[model samples]
Target: MNNNKSISVQNLTKKFGNFTAVNAISFEVEKGEIFGFLGANGAGKTTAMKMLIGISKPTSGEAKVAGFDVYKDTEKIKKNIGYMSQKFALYDDLTVRENARFYGGIYGLSKKQIKKKTNEFITELGIADIADNLVGSLPLGWKQKLAFSVSLIHEPKVVFLDEPTGGVDPITRRQFWEMIYKQADNGTTIFVTTHYMDEAEYCDRVSIMVEGKIEALDTPENLRKQYGVDSMNAVFLKLARG
Candidate 1:
C-alpha cells in the first residue's frame, strides 16, 4: 500500500443480478487531491462510489480507501471517511447546533469535543447568530456549507461528495468549492461527483465514466487538450454522447 495514496482500486466491479453497474475499473486517488468523478445519469459513478464508501460490496476486484480494504475493513473505512450526498442530510427540524452535535455523536465524539467543535464551526461559518435556528430556516447555501462542515466533524481522512452543488446558485457553488479547497489544503482527500462541468475543472484530476467504464482520467487541462476541446463541458458532451 502506498502511504501517499488515499484510494486505490484494481479491476473493481459491481453487478446487480445480471446487470453490471460498474464494470472492471481501476483508479487511484492521492491524499489531499480533489478527484472529480464525472458521468451522466446512469453512468455508474454512484455505484462505484458506494463501493469505495463500503455501503455496497463489489462483485470482484480489490479496493482500498484510506488505507483500509473496502471489503474487509469497512468499519475502519467508515470511521476514516465522511460523506455528503445530493440531498441535505441534516435534520430539517434540528437547530444548526443540534445537527452538528448529532452528527458528531454518530462519529463517536465525546460531548465535550462535540460542543467545542460545534462552537468553533458556528463561529467559523459566521452562523453564531443563528446557531439556535432550525436548519430548514437557513438559506440553501448556508445549509449546504453547514452540511459539509458537519461531515468533517470527525476529521475524516477522506470526504466523498455526491452532486453536492446540484441546486445552488453560481456564487454558492464557488463558495462551496472554496471550502473544498480549504479541506484539501488541510490534508483531506476529496472524492466528488458532479454534473456541472465547471465543477470538474476545479479538481486536481478527474475521471469521466461512460457506460460503466472510465474513458478518461487526467488533469482538466490535459483532458481538454486530449479531447481537442476548449472546455470540460465540450469534452463531457463529446464523451457522453458517444
Candidate 2:
C-alpha cells in the first residue's frame, strides 16, 4: 500500500453465482478526499464498495483500505473505517444516546470515551431535545444525521456512505453535505454512493459505474467538458444510452 492512498482497488471483481456484479473495476481514493461513487440501480456501485470495505470478498483481484489488505486484514480494515448504509442501520428501539453508546462500544470505545463523544455529538448537532427519544420516533432527517454521527463515533480514518441521503428533503440533504464537508476537512476520507446527479457535483472526483464497469471517472467539471454536456445527468444519459 502506498503511504498517500487511503483506499486502493486493483482489478476488483465480484460474482453472484452466474452473474458478474462487479467486473474488474479499479479505483483509488486519496486521503481526506470526498470521492463519489455514482451509478443507477444494478450498476455495481454497492458491489464494489462492499469489496473495498472488506465485508464482501472479491472473487478476483486485490484491494487495500487504510493500508491493510482487504482479504487478509478485513477485521483491521473494519476497525479503521466506518460504514453507513442506505437504510440508516441504527436500532429503532434505541434512544439517540443509547444508539451512540451501542456503536461506540462495538468499535471498542471505552465507557468514558463513549460518554464524552456522545455528549459532544449531541451538542454539536444541537439535537439535545431528541437525545433521549427513540430513533424511530424522530423525524427522518434527524435520524439520518444521527446515523452519520454514530458511524463516525470512533473517528475512523475513512467513512463509506451508501446513499446516506436517499429519501431526505433538499434542505436535509444540504445539512448532511455540510456535515460530510466538516468530516473531510478534519482529514476523514469519504467514499459515498448516491443516485442524485446534483450530489455527484459535490465530490472531489466521481466514478460512474455501468454494467459492472467504471465507464467514467473525473471531476464533475471535467466530465462535463469531456462529454460536452451541461450537467452530470446529461453525461450519465449519454453514457447509459450508448
List TM-scores for all candidates, in order.
0.99, 0.98
Q: What is the C-alpha RMSD of each candidate to the true structure, in Å?
A: 0.7, 0.9
Off-target runs (Cα >4 Å) in candidate 1 are: none
Which whole-number lDDT from 0 to 100 does residue 81 have in model 1?
A: 99
- Per-residue CA lDDT of model 2 for 38-153, tens digit only, reads 88899998888888888888999888999999899999999999999999788999999899999999999999999999999899999888899999998899989999999999
Q: How much does candidate 2 score in TM-score?
A: 0.98
Candidate 2 stretches with Cα past 4 Å from truth are none
lDDT for each candidate structure: 0.95, 0.93
Cα error of candidate 1 at position 87, Å = 0.9
Which 10 successive residues of model 2 have the least lDDT summed? 1-10
Q: What's the lDDT for residue 109 in model 1?
A: 99
- lDDT string for model 1 (113-141, tens) is 99998988888888889999999999999
